[model samples]
Target: MNKKIRFSDINMMNDYQEERWGYRVFELAVTNILNDELLQKKFPSLNEAFFQKVDEIIAPLQLLLYPVISCFSKDPDVLSQWRAYADDGRGFALGFNGVALNSMPVTLLEVEYDQKIQIEEMKTALLAAHIRNLESGNDFGSQFRTDCQLIGAWKVGFKNSAFREEKEVRSLHMLDVCVDGDRPRLVDAGGEALGKEVNGEQVGYRVQDGAIIAYVDIPIPHLDNAPLIQEVWVGPKNINGIGNIVYFMSECGLKDYAIHQSKASYR
Candidate 1:
């Protein structure tokens, strides 16, 4: 007979899944917000406000993203635990985790304010709403309170993610950018510098929109073994010639490059 795999056993195998699970929780909250009829009726502009709040909240919440991802990725056993709770059709298992449900009332307050559009008026409205819900003593009202608390916790996770921590020194490369029919330039920490006459310079080249451009090679010592190259583009198109640069970084073992910024294009 085959033995059932315990949640603990799965968790030990892959721990990063916990973070992913947290994201799932966040998604559930979003769904609830979208589906809440009373919430929608109370705040006719709920959709816009909800999304706007989500954007404002995401940066702070990002701190939790990686940890939750890591938790689930590092442990497969945790999934079993989550699945056991979600065995019912709902895909969410509500347990009394004792997470405070009313600590951060900003989102709720915002919802109330949005309805009244007046500070003092909204405060009175929210107080009345809270009292009315409490007085009902119904399961629906209780669940509504629970959902609000869960959303608050999710926000806390996001705020926590925004806090900075010490990061390990990693190798990074610099790519000099040059434009056609103009002087060559290199970019570094200080800024862009025009190229002077130099012998035995190994220039790197990349094709952009079918035009081959030249780059001066500065072998970054720390990043010598680093496979990624961070390219800073200088243009004959501009006075400084350093218009846009691309930074190539690694995330989750995948090589990716981003166009950091760009200048206004002529023509």
Candidate 2:
């Protein structure tokens, strides 16, 4: 099907939100990494610069791999995962994640947050960025205008109801243990640890406030989850650009997408 993948608007988005809406958890992390100070002035706070980087990555991929979340609750605990996800006062133009995008329902049913979300059982890392060296960009969360910045997944449990407001909110756990990345460190997780692997033999991590951060010697991984916006998902008008992106990505030897698929077998 030739579908139009779009960054939605207020009116149309309200419709999606009322139904089922989703956001790419990695998108926020990629945005922060793109604006890294180490990259010098390559990334500016300006919309053009930011989006250009975003489009560069998206222009090349197969959109089918990109997933989003829909039917999210307005509960404060849920919103705390990425506080800046909404509220302009936070920082950056995050309208895309909020009102703009829609999730692929087929993919979403597999990772439903309410299906007994916990630390060990959660093997998939929604988003992970490495903090190589002390100055590594783990602080990207702080730069992005969010109070809660941690390397963890949103542990969710919910109760459904006919009435939206009457629905029960059970839990949202931003679970993470801080380690010292200054030495050899291994966060014993099968797939939930999405960030790039460290190269140093001795490093450590520590959880301060509510975030998990580390300092290491390896080249920190920028963002972990598979990105949204692929050529397969794009409209016909942009096929040519997407084609070129695919070609370039192949020629440049970009890393192939190797994300963990959900094991949930639903009826």
Candidate 3:
């Protein structure tokens, strides 16, 4: 009766610009800092060598655990969302309970698309990483690595302004691969197959557009006396009727949820 939710790789997302914009912002911030004479004079510790070191640490994290994300749109019935994501009005849009979503052990945050804000955030993370590196006396760069992981995960949440209209709130989690002898295993945030297993499979991978995409199925707990799912919006081109939807929901043991028809006139 418990359903598992899948979070896909940010890089393998439908949007080609996913996470690329954030990296560009990071690059731009570092470039500006390195070029500015007054800034370099003020913070002599943050030189090219320091930036390169930070990049070296961060690059592996980015490659190894490129933050898998589950995105939820604030507007459930937008025309563009339906067309771009939902098989051009043929699929259904599920509305989840925000309160229930927040209750789960996940990193749920709103996506930032503003270039100016992203640049500032990138700069701040870089400065913090540098400070952490300087303070780590015995453990070496361990604290910096931990800080970079958080910052790297944060970078995945930064999308381009073009996707700003989606008004997305994303659940971010990292997927790390550890090679043990012959086989490679996927590790999640908490290391328990990224939380839990689904149907004896902790993680699942499928080929999409000739590329293998990895996803983890996290169990969605049924809230006590509350519905985890709020509603289901039938897409514009969907031919299913009210009776069919009601029957499906009933058979699935889903209760206290409404079904609405999308108002979009797309054929």
TM-scores for the candidates: 0.22, 0.19, 0.85
Residue range 1-267, candidate 3, lDDT tens digits:
466578887779878987667678878889877887887787788888887766776667765765777899988899999998899999899998876776554678888889888888888888878777777752436687777677766777788888888999998766667676988777665432334432323667889989999887676656788787789999999989888888888887887888888999999
TM-score quality measure for candidate 1: 0.22
- The best-first sequence of candidates by lDDT reads 3, 1, 2
Better of 1 and 3 by lDDT: 3
Compared with the true structure, all predictions reach lDDT values of: 0.29, 0.28, 0.77
List candidate 1 stretches off by more than 4 Å.
1-13, 63-267
As for TM-score, the candidate ahead, 1 or 2, is: 1
Candidate 2 on 36-153: residue-level lDDT in tens? 5654353234234434433343333222111112333333222222232333122111111221122211111223333223222322221121212113453333422221121121
Better of 1 and 2 by lDDT: 1
Candidate achieving the largest TM-score: 3
Candidate 2 deviant stretches above 4 angstroms = 1-109, 113-154, 157-232, 236-243, 254-267
lDDT of 1 by residue, 1-267 (tens): 111111111112122342244344455444565577887677554464444444343424322211110111111123333333233122221111111111111111111112112223423333343444445652334544443334433322221121112111111122233444675443322212122222323443565556554433332112223333222222213233112121212322313322221232321
Candidate 3: the clashing residue pairs are none
Clashes of each: 29, 28, 0
